[model samples]
Target chain A: MAKQYEFRIKGLPYLLVLPQMVIVFIFFFWPSAQAIWQSFFLQDPFGGQYIFVGLENYRVLFTDESSAYAQSFWVSVVFAVSVTVLAMSLSLFLAVQANKKIRAASFYKTMMIWPYAVATLIAGVLWLFMFNPNVGVVAWFLKHKLGYEWQYLLNTGQALTLLILAASWRQMSYNFVFFLAGLQSVPADFIEAAAIDGAGPARRFWKIIFPILSPTSFYLLVMNLVYGFFETFPIVHQVTAGGPGKSTAILVYKVWRDGVVNLDLGSSSAQSVILMLMVIGLTVVQFRFIERRVNY
Target chain B: MKRFSLLMLALLLCASTVFAQIQIDWWHAMTGKNAAALEELTKRFNDSQTAYKVVPVYKGSYSDTMNAGIAAFRAKQAPHIIQVYEVGTATMMNAGGAVYPAYKLMKDAGEKFDPKAYIPTITGYYSTSKGEMLSLPFNSSTAVMYYNKDAFRKAGLDPEKPPVTWPEFFETAKKLKASGMEGGFSTNWISWIQLENFSAWHNQSFGTKNNGFDGLDTKLVFNTPLTLKHLQTIYDLSKDKTFIYGGRENKANPLFTSGTVGMHFESIGGYGNFKNTCKFDFGVARLPYYSDVKDAPQNTIIGGASLWVFNGKPKEDYKGVAKFFTFLSQPESQAYWHQTTGYLPITVAAYELTKKQGFYDTNPGPEVAIKQLLNKAPTGNSRGIRFGNFNIIREIEDQTWEDILAGKISVKDGLDKMVNDGNAELRKFERLYKK
Candidate 1:
């Protein structure tokens, strides 16, 4: 009778969460574990054979002089971090501006979010045409209006600029939505009190508004960084193709290339495991060092 | 009461089984006009046969179809037949028991499946050394040059005569650009047409052992000076704006058809689209070559895709597939397909049948691709690439071209990188087979 009581008390939470737990284990956690397991093996694309090589794939990924693996990994980090910061900052600025009782603020807010409605694939296609060397409107402006002999598609720096712009454009809208919601929830009495203390717009923003928006910024940064690596794949593949000599080859694209394009599941899995480790290590570092600086 | 209920259920099952038709589902990547043609063909086959019903479903693109098939196979829910692109041959061949060879399927169905019936150059590429035909040929095509006759005439060049060699082609391209054409010369499938097909047409090995046909241990051999020089030619043209670099693959076709480009080198499948579009006068010709090489020009290889039957299909359904293939290979059907679409006739008899019907005379550019392909038997290099992971190799080539076009890397350096990286992919594929 005592054991039954213990079992009933202990197993109640597990019983309640069983269905969700099973789904998470089967679909998410299982694939991740298998990916880690596959990282230790080498797979042949043609014959579908697997050979255990004990971190050889990782070794190739980390230290290979000629492979694009290391380059893509570093690029992904830079891309993710830069896009996250830029998007968060821009969204915060726009959200603060729109929070006021200015005329037509709703109209401005609505227009800012229009880019989020466009699918990444469709956006990529539109960007390709917009950057076309011969017929693109941007090309015409660069050559004729600005008198600059510039092409965006083939230039690495310009290509990256466009990619970040497109990525940040969508992300800024999402961040704006979140930050606006967070800003609205910040209790209007606090903002009114700060303004009564002879604080300027800049001071109020830095002292009161921004401090409260820190949590929202942190959340948006994490989500945007993850999207930059994973969700950005369709746009990158469709537009740049990691071209101009692999200037924009990100980590997740490398995983997709290795797995789907090359059919080397082992190498792809190794890339995935490495990417996971990198994201985790990065998150931990940020929490340890940067979280302390948060005003909240 | 329970026994009676179970007996009734069994009887109901038996009754339904008596009149039920064996359904075969096919997944293909053909869309637009070609999709319509395929639907018509399948509908005709379904009407002709009562034993089995063949259903054709349009999957998105070539890569999408291949990925879907791979995922389905992993889930044990694959369709009966899948139309795999030419580049995916290696992946499909390496699938082992997941696929059923057409030879085996036909034999099991007590149907006559002859490898000799197909064009040697086309069939040999997809067949094993044992001469087993693994897949049935569907929409076979080859690369050809599409020229804007109006642009040529405006440039003071003959609208009827196309350049025969690389030097002549380049010279004409310069002339076309000098004539103040907005876009001079562009190409689709830059990697496929320029690198892969360039190597084939020049009889140069893209990889060792005739592009990995002999074994998986094949290495990339596309870094030779000849290949580098050819790549440099295009790269130099891009720098000069004489050659307009379009998107990576299949992205330049619309530009050509829309009259933005004076000349375009693309797969012959563009015939239907170009015919429909292109308000300007246009002509098609054989792909140009480098005159310096010995026996420089050769018949170009096929593009498009093939229909591969899967393992899980029934014997009766295989009979239906065979019958459909035979019907597809008929002279009238082949002529209609060739005349209407840009794909080449797969069978020699159908080709001759098309010629006898004077379809070529009525439509000038339609016959140019077939004539280019059948002009000579494909040699070792010109036949086709059979290496595993070839699609990735093409991806590497695409990036290399981008690098060259962007002036980020020298032509020689780009080709060297392509060879090195492509060889790594080949080695990876080879290890799979050896194991």
Candidate 2:
């Protein structure tokens, strides 16, 4: 009952994928392999020489007596989870509002998507300007009108909160686009039938629209986690610099600070490998468990 | 058409000839106004010579520039020269076969270089224990106290006489606060000013082995009774809102310049920024010391960048580098740079030249930094600190200090943690460099 067709060209498939394969190997796999190799060795800053010290770097990181490594891991988890939840919920809410048959909906959608075009670092700088304790307009208002001394510079909790808000603010636009698309694709007739059956807006959204959007939501959850974990470095760097006493020093920020600023290539590489494993483990769990509930 | 083609060919040939000249690339981390000043100096060097053209490239911040330089060196495309920050000195020095020491390069190139010509506190920082200069000191500054003269006058303190001792400083801060100033005192570079320079300024050892100058096996010893007393003073000050913890590393500069904080401790290099920004007159003074400590008020350490020559460059490029350094060393050029940038004059001759030109008479603040550098002969501890992995050690210090300030840990516990964490980093660095 099966029909097979062959072009009789042995190298065509390979030829067709050669460019992408070459790019992926050169850009991704090669560097990752190099990181794995470098993680096993202690190297000078200038790369003049290297000594293979087999797992010493990992041992030092895990056995750190100061608990900096462990604390950064927890900080990363809190940051990534908070950013994902905050960004996703906010974007979903905005998408739902924009999906309604309201006047100037297209204009609202376009304006909402404008933040996606701004660079991440610029977004961070903008937020910094607004929240800076000394010179920020919002800080001035909080100090003068609201009678609240907003000192993120000294308060670790406040600094972390500011970073989360800034990071999630930048990510909202990206999640909104996906969520809006997902909401649009949900058949309107289902909602109409539910309305006819006396279902309220909240009930319809909870029972019908949310399940229909599960696939997109799951996809976005994974993406937002990765973004929060790895790609929020610029925001941290530009805003808090993982400071106010290392309270905001996330895992990825530590990797950069150690590798680039401190020039400890071995430790940085080991941390990168650890982060890679974490992401792999997370993605596997998501696909195995969360994907089961994602309808289609 | 034939004549037009010939003219175009002539222009192309001329352009190629210009490009053929050895281009000495100098990667630096200067940005904004400083970048423009650096570019002007480079243009002067280029116009002054036809044999070599020194091209300056703006390469992000200090750490970013160092990373880029390291990556480029690995790719075997390193620049001829790089501007390394003061903290990166040890790393650059230990980068075997990757750099040509400034003294050796100058000597081998037969340049008329005199190590003694530079200010001792300035050159001693980038030198070996034997006083051999490892890198050419370009822009150097020492920590000093910056006071708002208007605020001091308003607080009924002598505007001309800044507090010279810790007790006096605290009293003045209280007075400023009593005078209704929002912030009485703050500081930038807490670790650098409070601990490192504080130890050096009191002639107390910050670490063993001459502040890590002699070898890589140095351990941090700044967690002493003296440092504890100073930190306790700051802690008490913070309790009363007299001393505002203005984040870290020049973040407090705005508090001083905005006239909110009456007194601020910052690098003398902040002169230009303060002069440009502060609406009220600001005065520079030597960093305060504990009055009870004998031999207190030793020379403070330098805290700016230097020009390092990398290896694996053409011999001609080395010669160009030597020539450029010679040009920079000229008294006129050094004085000009000092006047413009507010960085200390590297050479004694430059200082004398600047004084002879009556620059200090009109601009009184810069002389304080220069005088602070030349205050006394640098003792063992007063000489700059040079330890491997100092960058990480600095982070540890900052974190510990923050913890102490935030009341998360006791002063002794925080300082003890700093020593432990810093020693571990040093051990790691020693292992890496041992081979």
Worst 10 residues of 2 chain B by lDDT: B251-260
Top candidate when judged by TM-score against the true structure: 2
Kindly list the per-residue Cα lDDT of model 1 for residues A1-296, writing each as its tens digit: 45533455777878988999999999989999999988887764333567788988888887886567878877877888878888888988888889888999999999888888988888777876777665577866887789876665578888787788777777788888999898898888887898898888789888888778777777677788888887888778877778766789888777887787667788889888877787787689668755775555
| Model 2: share of true interface contacts reproduced | 0.65
Prediction 2 global C-alpha lDDT: 0.89
lDDT of 2 by residue, A27-137 (tens): 989989989999999999888779999998899889965647988999989999999999999999999999999999999999989988889999889998898886677
Model 2 segments more than 4 A misplaced: A1-5, A285-295, B1-16
* Candidate 2 TM-score restricted to chain A: 0.93
